[model samples]
Target chain A: MSRRRPSTRTVLLAGLAVTVVLAGVVSFYASGHPDGLEYVAHSLGFGDSAGPHVSDNSPLSGYGVKGVHNARLSGGLAGIIGVLLVGALATALLYAVRRRAPRD
Target chain B: MHVPDGFLTAQTSLATAAVAAVGVGIALRGARRELDDRTAPLAGLVAVFVFAAQMLNFPVGAGTSGHLLGGALAAVLVGPFTATLCISVVLLVQAIAFADGGLTALGTNVTLMALVGVWVGYGMFRVARAVLPKRTASVPIAAAFGAALSVPAAAATFALLFAAGGAVPIATGKLLTAMVGWHVLIGLGEAAITFLAVGAIVATRPDLVYGAQDLRPDHADLEIRDGVVV
Candidate 1:
């Protein structure tokens, strides 16, 4: 018997679900240690030279919503927002490019 | 690796910014060839998936964590041109909205992760594919090898940039060693993730996989019999 291929919608929705879960819930459990670059910078004595981000005032700075005391909720909300915004922007850009692509 | 503000000299930052802009412009044009209406949205979804995956920083070693750059994975799923754009979009969003990466350093991040990562990973994937068997299984294995190398390669590039024009003076030799060493560990995680993700996709939806496109059967009725058309 031949297997039925998943529709694009099904694939997309599945991807969305995975993104939501990973970004929203599992992210909170990520290792809190400094990343590779940051660790090296600190050990090498240049980590102190790092300056503040220009968008530090953004409501979603540091992947946490501003003024939300609940860490989990804030981070989860920020993650969800990020996934949605990225999805939207990517879709728009890709669609625009597709429109511009020469038809074969 | 996301370079923070005040890390590199203004001149270096500006130079990288110019390079990144040119790279993105080229990618924008090239991505047009890779994307069609049906697959355009797949590029977007790839970005979203990468962004989310980047958030989960798994520990590599020595109190240091690493996350998926998604370059190899994206290039295998989508074409490299579209993968570059996808990663660029992710970095841009992270910088502008989340402030995860520095605004001034956006160009550096784009160059390192989007351009360098994608090209190196994709190139390595192609090289590996050339040597490996042409079976569909080879796609993910090649992707894994590529992803493993791309992390350390990006780290080396950052070290080179820093050597050229770091805002603060440091020993370049030691810094390079440390950066490359740590990233080599991180590259293992990159390989694992890339392998699993690409393997799963190739198994379930070979049609959606860009790198494995050649592995797909041409058509049901177009079989060759004994090297002769029948």
Candidate 2:
């Protein structure tokens, strides 16, 4: 008998669910501590060497929305927007590459 | 680690940016060979998933936190070349949209996370798989080891770059030791996430996993017997 496989739709949907939960809901609870690099920089006294970001004025700077006051809501909105934007860009790039790939 | 602007001398950043450009050009060609109609969308999803995952910073210790770089995870899910593209996309979005990384430092971040991290992790995965038994279980095990090593490897790469042209003068030895030490701890988190994610995917949809593709035939047969192939 032929074996069945999980449909692409199912797998994609599952992935979407995980991404939504992690980026949209759970991201607010992430630790606020400096990451490994930033921690090292601060400890080593070179943290001051870092310059200002070019996009410092971006509405979504620092992963939080500019106008939103509620920390959770701002972060969650920014994360969701990031996921969607990245998802769309990656999909377009991959599909474009696939279209150009050699047919075999 | 995302290196911000002015962290490295302009000369070093420019040189690394050139290298990053060449690497990304190669990756674009390689990804074309790897992506297909079906897998292409999955690759996109992998990028999305990685971006989402990176938002959650899990604390390591001593006021230090780390997030998933997702290089190994993406390499195992998709092929390495596509993994490079996935991470490059993430970094691009983070830098441009979120302003999380420096715009001028985009190339450095891509080189460290996308190129070095993915290649080292994928290479280690290949080596571990070769030495280990040719079973489905070996996939996640090898991936865990690969993911674990990749973090420090990237940290070391950064150390080398800093040594070459850090904006500020610091002891290279001290930086290397500190970076490698902290990153080793971060590597544990990388391994755990890679192992769990790969294991979960292999359990439900092994065929979708690029690194586990070799074991698909046997896995499919076993799933058929268990009445869970679907």
Candidate 3:
């Protein structure tokens, strides 16, 4: 293979590959502890004030799919779905709003 | 920080939503100027990457964890306008599908992480880049500096929002202290991550990095001595 710099397409594909692995596989091993804001809320005595999420019953709630008993698979499925959904929406919005070719 | 619903009053949530709407509208216009065919795809990838990274929460001592906010990294890779949109999209996906953040509080989350996080991080990056030496290497360093502070700055803004429209009657000062204190630790991790990501990309594709565009060495810098750069 030539030692020339890889094209931008290669770079983006590489990045997407890493992103998929992180979201779909590695995420299952992340810490289960509360995030900084949640910790602060609990410690500061407002923890109980938080209401239930409106989408708590979503099929992919809490990053896990319903009825997917295998913990890893459930989380991984949910994550991949989210990745696709977010990627599609973000890409569409950005593409639509991208600068058009200048009028001659 | 992804704020849960019910922590803030309905009125406050609505107000923040309005603010987020305005911020996003302006960003939409600004992003048009920033996004050409080349960079628009990168901006979308940034949102996807942030969504992925946020799923990997690192422990920050005391049984608490923090995840990547990604605003600084996004702003460094794409311009701030696109960075804001990127984060907003991630937050929206999380809210609707993952049930992570609240739907009612979506605007609040957007305001904090999208608007405040992106602008503050980008602003700090510019300030740091100006103070640091004018070298391509300094871009990631400056971005890291910005990442370090952006977390706490967003947290602090959340604290102020709580004070304004919090459902509970808590002492604002103590809440601010707690928010800032914990987030400061989180910010350190943010700095390290931002430095690595930005540095890696900047090293490989310096031309694609928005923040380093100015610092990139011009072709005019080359001095040809019989067709060999002196």
The candidate that wins on lDDT is 3
Residue-wise lDDT of candidate 3 within A20-76, one digit each (tens)?
A: 999999999998899999998998889998888889999999999999999999999
The interface RMSD value for candidate 1 stands at 1.7
lDDT of each: 0.90, 0.89, 0.92
Higher-ranked by TM-score: 1 or 2: 1
DockQ of every candidate: 0.71, 0.69, 0.68
lDDT, candidate 3, B1-230, per-residue tens: 78889999999999999999999999999999889999988998899999999999999999999999999999999999999999999999999989988899999999999998899999999999999998889999999999999999999999999999998988999999999999999999999999988998887777789999887444455578999864
Query: Which predicted model would earn the best DockQ?
Result: 1
For candidate 3 chain B, the 10 contiguous residues with the lowest summed lDDT are B214-223
Fnat, one value per model: 0.82, 0.80, 0.85
Specify the CAPRI tier of model 2: medium
- For each candidate in turn, the TM-score is 0.94, 0.94, 0.95
Ranking by lDDT: 3, 1, 2
The runs of at least 3 residues in candidate 2 whose Cα sits more than 4 Å from the true structure, single-residue gaps closed, are A1-5, A99-104, B218-230
Candidate 1 lDDT over residue span B81-147, tens digit each = 9999999999999999998877889999999999888999999999999999998889999999999
Which scores higher on DockQ, 2 or 3? 2
Residue B30 lDDT, candidate 3, scale 0-100: 95
lDDT of 2 by residue, B1-230 (tens): 88889889998989889988999899999988788887998898899999998998999989999988889889998999999999999999999988888888999999999999999999999999899998778888899999999999999999899999998888999999999999999889999988998887777777788998877545425545466564
- Model 2 lDDT at residue B75: 95
The CA lDDT at B66 in model 2 is 92
